[model samples]
Target: MSKLTPLGSLPYPQPTDVADVPLHLQSLAEAIDGRTVLRFTDIANLQARVTNPVAGMVAWLGTPGRLFHYAGNHWAPVAPGPVHKVNNNEGSTTSTTFVETLTSATGDPMAVSFTAPPSGSVIVTVGAYTYNSAADGLAYMSAAVRLGTTVKLAAHEDRSSIVRSAARVSASTQFQVSGLTGGALHTVTPAYRAGGGAGNTASFDNRFVRIDPVT
Candidate 1:
């Protein structure tokens, strides 16, 4: 029986421990640097071909997001469509207070004609503002929709005279005006007075929305 012996093991040179070597396989402090940094060969290429690139952009880079920094550094929810402003300044003019007293054909008089939400009837908010400081115009004057002889909604004070000066508030908003009889021969009585005389003309431009009946 021939004695079986293990094949001679090749003795290869062993690499020395780099822990004691100064610059042998050891990364230099200058190469590492104190500041943390990530090297990228081609950012745009990686982004274009990267998986879930859109998600990466949203997470890493502040881009391709719906939110925006509109007013300040804080992020705000972006509106999908155009923003609608309910009111705007109509300017001021030297004029008298134009008071209109609306009457119901049956003898009950009211200012506005809004009863239901979807109805064509709308409530109007009339505000009086200063026209000219030189004219000593009224500072603040306002009124709201009145349904009948007794009911007055959103009542505000006329802090200053509305006649013979530039009115500060020429803006108005539409509200639902209802609860009164419709098609009752509504009549409106217009009256105004300037600072000097009863015949003085007062002018005011109001902002109003067109009434559309919803079926």
Candidate 2:
């Protein structure tokens, strides 16, 4: 009997087969990866090519070239299309504590301006910073999120730690807004309010905000 063997590398290899014409006497990786990249016009055509496919086998659809993995006797989509994001982080502003609420833009106008991603929801976070002695812990800093004058989210946190330093926090608040129209420029801003009307000044640290899509 003549012993079968693979005499060359794949994609154009010579094989003296023991029944597996394209995979005879090949290495483990070559034997598995060599003969399993099946191509077809679509799902229907793929079914016509092989009556039974082993689990994990892939089919590359010819029309759009999307890949699918076989499982539970069916081919399922195996690729995540894409992800998108939007951000705004710039400038700085102080806070004026009073009986009224404040917008994020007033503190740091640049850090609050962002364009919404096409027709998708976004997760937003805003930060309120305070510069205190850590002992004057009497200073209360609050931050809020707004889109073109619409208040989407708002929250407040307090800590008088003046330790003669600045601190940043989310004030235990976050927002998730949906139904964004594609290509629309929405101005996002973060504003702040301290304890005393003009008496309480929020330093630049209180004006930080971030926004990103939920996709």
Candidate 3:
């Protein structure tokens, strides 16, 4: 009698069966033809070798050490993209209108730029240590995450005689932007503003921004 392996169903001949050696060998060879991951030097090599790849077929590229799988129409990476982070602790704004946070004395905005993946969303997070100069009445400080001229996320906190004057508070905002243009460069910026009183000031320090891409 003969049975088949559980996974690939390769032929397994019993000792009592006495099957022909050539027949068993041919069956095994046919069953194992496309059972292993195809290896190539790079994407070009993979494309040259595999012209008619079916869905679920996987290939390993040597140059970048990435695994790709065919999705019936295109090949996609198995791993997510890398994360980007930037930090700055210089400069402050007192305007009531939202503006880019400066990272340097020369007025460089606290911004981070990265390339967006072909088909995925990006998550942006901004955080800072906030300060309001006014002690009496209500004072508010707002922080926002911006992509170009668009504001992705914004949040504000009010401090009205809650604690001692000039106390520092933490303000942060996070947003996920989807349907981004593939292979496009994206710049994320953090902004801040102040309101609720005359001669009041809002300041930010120890600012940080992070970007993550999901595919």
Candidate 4:
């Protein structure tokens, strides 16, 4: 009969029974420690476990392949895995609001602003809504992702559809960019110009933007 030593530590502290040997080994595969095991748990449960966590504590979450490590403050995915971060503003209004400074209350930026990870690249998704048949009774909208003043992604509605105002429309697009310096700030925005319609005098509604990084 033999007992087992603690995990990740030196060998034996003579066990009192041979029967416990198989049980201890079974637990080793199921738990993180002798008392605590973390396998497939949701993000909420994962956060609850490490309420007073230290740096470098890691666990598999939500599924077998989803591994996360707890840094001092938050949980970060294990290396070689994609990391996602999102910033968005929501509300309702009836007016022409174009991209400007990041006045979230008014949606001046019309996009999500974020700090780039050390990866120097990220993918951005832009979403927005607007209603304006004002100009030529047609409404047009455009969107872009920018690394500082340099535009990385941009798109606009065709004049026929956008310029001729209908009901509000969901404007969404995505783009990937590289060569950015990690830890830099990036922004995405919505815009309108003289495209398919003279609908420059239209109105706008809800808008949002998001960015994801794959390193």
lDDT by residue (70-172, candidate 1, tens digit) is: 2122112232221111223233323444333211112112233322222224333333322444354332333344334544333333312243354443433
- Which segments of model 4 are wrong by more than 4 Å? 1-105, 134-140, 143-164
Point out the higher-scoring one by lDDT: 3 or 4. Answer: 3
| Model 3 per-residue lDDT tens digits across residues 62-114 | 96788877766666666646655545455555666666654242334656765
Candidate 2's TM-score reads 0.36
Q: Model 2, range 71-101, lDDT digits (tens) per residue?
A: 6445655552332222233223234342223
What is the TM-score (0 to 1) of candidate 1? 0.24
Q: Which ten residues in a row have the lowest lDDT in candidate 1?
A: 101-110
Q: For candidate 4, write residues 1-215 as lDDT tens digits.
A: 43345655423325454557666665555444523435646667766755676576777876435666654556555653333332344333233433333322454655566545556677655545644544345444455667788886654452112434546666655666667655455675655533234334444455555567757
lDDT of each: 0.30, 0.47, 0.61, 0.52
Instruction: List where candidate 2 sits over 4 angstroms from the true fold.
Output: 1-108, 133-173, 196-200
Worst 10 residues of 2 by lDDT: 82-91
Error of 4 at 79 (Å): 7.3
